[model samples]
Target: MRFRRYLDILFVFILFTKTTFAQGNSCTDDSTAGPDDPHSFDKAFDADKGYGYVVYGDLYRFDCCGTVKRWDFSIGDNGKIELQIWRPVDKKGKIFKLIGFNEYTVTNKNRKSGFVTFDVPDKERLSTEEDDVIGWYAPGDSLIEYTDGTSYDGIWKVAHDDNLKVGDSVDFSGGLDQGSRTYGIQATLAPNTAPKFDPMPDKKISMDINVGTTIYTVKVDDADPADVADLKMEMTTKNDFFMFNTQTGDVIVQSTITVPVGGQTVTLDFKVTDHCGAEGTGSLQVQIDYVGDPNTTPTTTKAKTSKTSPKVKTTITDKTTTDVKTTKETKITETSVAPVATDKNTDKNDKTTAKPDLSTDQDPSNGTMSAMTGGSSVDAALIGGIVAGIVGLIIIIVVTVVCVVNKKAKVRPSGKDPEKANNASKDNAKNDAKDKPSPTDKKPPSDSKSTMNGKPHVKDKG
Candidate 1:
């Protein structure tokens, strides 16, 4: 249990434990807390089977691996012992729990009788790191001294109102009391405070990475909860691609990883240890990029011929009328200005506008063409200069509305001569729209009507 908040939230700094402690130095296992080492007949339990319960008491560890901060028990038994420190998530001795705790009480008195020691402070110290142990609890029998056979590693007991805090997680290694003997349990080491990481950055692998994929989680940063509780994903150089997690530094993708084509790289290297051996390294890379022959068909890249795109297109077809350009299918071509226009004077109503649709608006690869000549036909000088500028603007609006209706019929008799109607409107505006009336001498109209009789000098302002 992350040592019950010994440090979390991405640890920032703190590397202090430079060894130093002296209650009988040399790593103290016997710094004296005696009454001749918890034995008044060495029977803290099995008191002839009146064995009350709740107690783990002995297993111990402290072969110099650091910081226990003092503990040296021996007890007589008034009650209340609590001094746990289990940290053993399987170093092979099966499972174990409770991270670090400390309490101490003993009043009245009875049995073995003797020292006590304690100090523990630095926030419940006890951070052994390798098989770590050193237990004790109380709610019954005398309180110290045990000595039976031997197997240990797990031991549950509960109920003094369910007590066993600090993330309680026991196993008891299946009891029948295979053994239990730890006279005045001890621990005092001191130096051992490493573990760091939170500065990694060398990963670079954007996208494609198959085989079971997970890729990276490790962040580690510290203040020792026994150094970020159990972390250890070391891989200085091992490959088959990936697969981390030596106690959650997670990292997966175990194989089939590649990088070698038009562009390539590979990398990998790793490290992040913690059970007191301390480490923190990184790298990952990957990078690759080929692309060619993706099923062989992706080559569209010719776009550099610009001098104003639109090399001529206007194709408006449809046999229309008075330039009416209609024709959702049109016909009625008896020319010579409708020369007796047959099909019963074929005039199913004419009048129309809007153009474009010369078979898909020109250039179906040719037709009214001009894809710079690659599309053929129809460019007879850009359609004869756009049909002679729309037939000279429809013959000057039909000879200025027929000389303003023949000069308004000689000034309508006397709506005032007004200087002889301004000199007959300047001689009927120089009368000359080819003297009017000529659809080859008129007669054909009626394609339902809308014909300048087919371009009579192009006059059909209607």
Candidate 2:
């Protein structure tokens, strides 16, 4: 019986030793496992560094095992434990720790199925510590207490080796420790919000002028008043026309009077832009008056010639002349008168002496006579035929003289005047030769007859 008892004890001892060894091996096997190890846990209870232990509450502990468990105790619940924990060691040992408090208003069981998320603080001041917190819990410790006061203790397994992405979900198990629990807490990754931007609007305005016209058509491009706010236009006239800008691009007739000739209009355009980068434009139209060229009267020129009347005069004279002439004549008649007185008595006595007296009586008689008569007649006539004939002759002579002078002035010698002079000189030389005596006249005087080369010569003198 003693032997059997010893055998049983030894067998029990061997079984116990095997179990302890297997447990210790299991723990040691997962100690070096990474956080992402499928079989290892992500969180655990740390007692030496006091990172995940509650002073008065139950100390929930987690290991590298795949199982999730929780230990409830008053001291573990009261002990201060950081809400967030990270483990860099692959071995199931907690390496990093955070300090924070947790309120207990509800049991750990009621705090399951939700997550704790951190966001930018709304009113909390940032700490200047080396590990300053950029964000805090959204609901804060109060909201965490309101939701459920729970102590978490579980393994926090990294689902992936990559850092937290923009949108990642973390599952929290129901436990209180440095590990993420599926029931106690949960976390959701959200994308950061983008900033708002407001840009100024783009605007442009332009104007064009057409010479000599009051009316103008304005063209606008990409113009919208609502897009471009605060637009103003001012127009001024230069020379003949006024120009200004309106809200829209259009032709506006601003002048009521008729446009003068060669007149121009001035226009101005002002545009503004809105905050949305839109543009608006306007144009001004000016009416100009037309003026015609000045009217001018043409001057006339007249040629004048003075005229004078001829003077005429007439003279008359009257005169009378008297002339007297006288002539005397003598006559003898005595014998006849004496004879009549003595005729009676003497006839008787005279008869006796009558013969003797008759013979002696010689009667002598003489007579003288004169006559006068006067009358005169005169005749006058004009004859200019000879003078007219002489004048015609003189005109003919003048014409002849002019023609002769013209002919003489145009006379020219052939072969130039010098050639003609040379020809004349040649003619004069020939004439001189002809007028010169022959060589015989210069011969020496030889006695009557001269002999040359033994030839005899005879001469006769005259």
Candidate 3:
């Protein structure tokens, strides 16, 4: 069943004609078809196969599919030839239907002796799948060729009927005549039509397509699959990078392509032969867009960090041959120096003390002094020293507060006997002075004042 569908037509325009710009190799072949080269021998069938009977010496297939343009045969004598063609249905073949038949009067000039031609302008197409029996008989003389060897199955002869039409199935079961023979018969073939490319006339690609990439697999739109190999292609490349793999029809990049600095267009030209005697030309374009190269090495510079440490130096002066003493007030001075520097030479008599490197990153692996280079150990020592100093200060404050409280408790509103308290205070004062550091210690000089009452007093040096 056939159904037709209609659509709402859009605005349409008409194109008059098409003109092809360029072309490639044309489909052109001038050769004869037979079991072997018919020209290689000159022997002819000198005997007649009788009138009113038909014979066929052609039953093999010609692999290259094309159109049978003409018929050729040789005759040594003047005769009449009735050509017959039977279409094959299977390998065994049949004489059921007739597709072609023609009668030709052979004379010395038109159909000559050695080899002659009978043009079949209709150009009956040849099939690669099966063979067409080209049989002919002579009501006067059927001139055949005597080749040295015969085909697998020799020629067959069958009785002819004048009433048989083109579509009538004629029975040849009882009319078979097998013989070792050959015909002067021959035929010429040419391409039926022009072939085209499957993918339009152009292909577009990118510069990013790497080498060895199958850019576009070549394909053709042709009617005959058996004649595909006979179609030749001509490819022209502006860039040597591209090539076609003939065996596989793959267009590949064989090497690198020189791309422009920015976006640009590059093209490769190609052409192929059609099934007919014509050419089909096409082109492939490549678009190159430059980004950046990853092969360039970058330079970098590292920043050097400089560190400083506070340097502390203690000096014993001539005024203090003994240990220095802390009075009511203490003074501190700090000095800073550059980071630790490596020394090739050392002063054996040096007495200066260097502080621990608190910023060192590596674990100490040497002696106990080196162990202090770690940040954790140095921080702990500093915390311990500060705590000890605080404890000593608290003890001094408690002692001073107790002395003041004792002096207040001994007071009796200035009415009790002052001599008893006075004598007890002198005794306490002598004991308190004994607990203090020796006077020989280097203590800052200050004025000392005493009161005549039975109470203690402090002297200010400000």
Candidate 4:
């Protein structure tokens, strides 16, 4: 009877052992266990210096939409780190999405090093979903560098399922101790912004020009308010007539531009690049032509001259002879003239006389001229003789008058009768002679007979 009782108790013990083993195996074998399960860490190790508890930090998502075929991260501490993915339920619960529990070991080869890539599991992609969180459980304390090169003491980020677009910011927080955290990280989608050309140049440019001159300036319009002082300008076209300054965007004429047939056009291509490697493009076109040339020839002119012809004159003469009391008819010609030159181009009505011979001779004795002449002339020899006779008679009358006046003057002084006056003169002379004593009678006295009358006369000596 006791043996039968012991066998029955052994059977009950075997069944109870089998039931406990099955329940334990169910918890350990379940790969899609939810976080609410009491034994959720059945596959996880205990928290120790070599292993740490799983930490659910903030959620992370890609800045843009993309498929993450591979992932990499830096290990700040030397230990194994397990990357886990979680998807949110309706309200506040989360479930583990298996990635074969991708885990990596950090050593001297990969400690504080570059990104280490992880192997993705088969038939399962670490895709992004809303309310998804990429988490990490570092078995030890660690640090990570921010985009600004600032190091923060914490566990590094893994992956995110954010829905933000490119160039949008993703701000998150991290902490060395789980419950105490601060917003310290931000990342932006690649290709932050597209470049643009603000304040673009004018579409068409116009200018007026004089020939043989140059256009020395070009316009540049760049609306970027940033520091354009260092912006670069490049002209793609190669033309000898123009040169451009890349530093200043100034276009100058290298030489005088020449116009071609059917006019001409100059095309220029310009590109501006900023310090950020973003670039903008623009173009310019110019048309030019030559109007005309500006030089000509000259001509000549003449001056005028005026001349007047010289004149010739002639005179006629007439004469009558008084020597024999007769008037004679004789042809006489005298031409008083000055030297003159005749011109054939002179007016027909203008009678220009020929030049006369100054060496011609004329008669001097007769008051008549016997020279050859073309016109009729009359001699005035009779009138010349009468004039000479009247002059001589006048001269004789003057002389006779002068002589008679002289004779009268002499007779008046002699008392009107010369003979009687002469006789009276003789009588007066005799009387004077009788009354005058002669010089001979009053002679100087000498010792002679004249002194006998007792009168002494002394001879005078001078």
* Highest TM-score scorer: 3
Candidate 2 lDDT score at position 333: 17
Model 1 residue 135 CA deviation (Å) reads 4.4
State each model's CA lDDT, in order: 0.47, 0.28, 0.49, 0.38
Error of 4 at 209 (Å): 6.1
Model 4 worst lDDT window (10 residues) = 25-34
What are the per-residue Cα lDDT tens digits for candidate 4 across 105-152? 767665534334454442233323222344444545432212211122
Candidate 3 residue lDDT tens string, 346-452: 11111112122112111234221111211232343454344334433443444445545755787655665788878988999999987787765467644554443
Off by over 4 Å in 2: 1-159, 162-182, 186-195, 198-423, 434-444, 447-460
Expressed as tens digits, the lDDT of each residue in 1-462 for candidate 1 is 686355532221121222221112223343322123443334454222222122333345444455667666555455666766665443334446677666777666433345466676665565554334666666565365555434552334333324557656665555344234435555555665555566545555532445677766666665555446555666576666676776676677776544444545556677765555556676666453444332333343322211111122222222222221422111222222111222211112212232221222332343432222211122322443343344334433444454567566865766656888888878887685657766655776544534454853543559
Residue 347 in model 3: lDDT: 13
The digit string of per-residue lDDT tens for model 2 on 1-462 reads 999888777756754553233122112111211112111222321223211221111122223211111111111121222233232211223222222222223335433422222231322211111111111121212122211223543333221212432123332222234333212232111111111212212322112223333344443332222212222322333322233345543334333333335554544544533322223444443333343222322232232222222111211121111111111111111122211211110100000111112111111221211111111100000112222233334334444455456555676556578677879899999999978987876987767776755898676568
TM-score of 1: 0.28
Error of 3 at 252 (Å): 51
> In model 4, which runs have C-alpha deviations exceeding 4 angstroms?
1-229, 292-462
Top of the candidates by lDDT = 3
Better of 1 and 2 by TM-score: 1
**Model 4 TM:** 0.23
| Runs in model 3 lying further than 4 Å from the true structure | 1-32, 39-59, 94-96, 110-112, 122-129, 194-462
Task: For each candidate in turn, give its C-alpha RMSD to the true structure in angstroms.
Answer: 23.9, 52.0, 23.4, 37.1
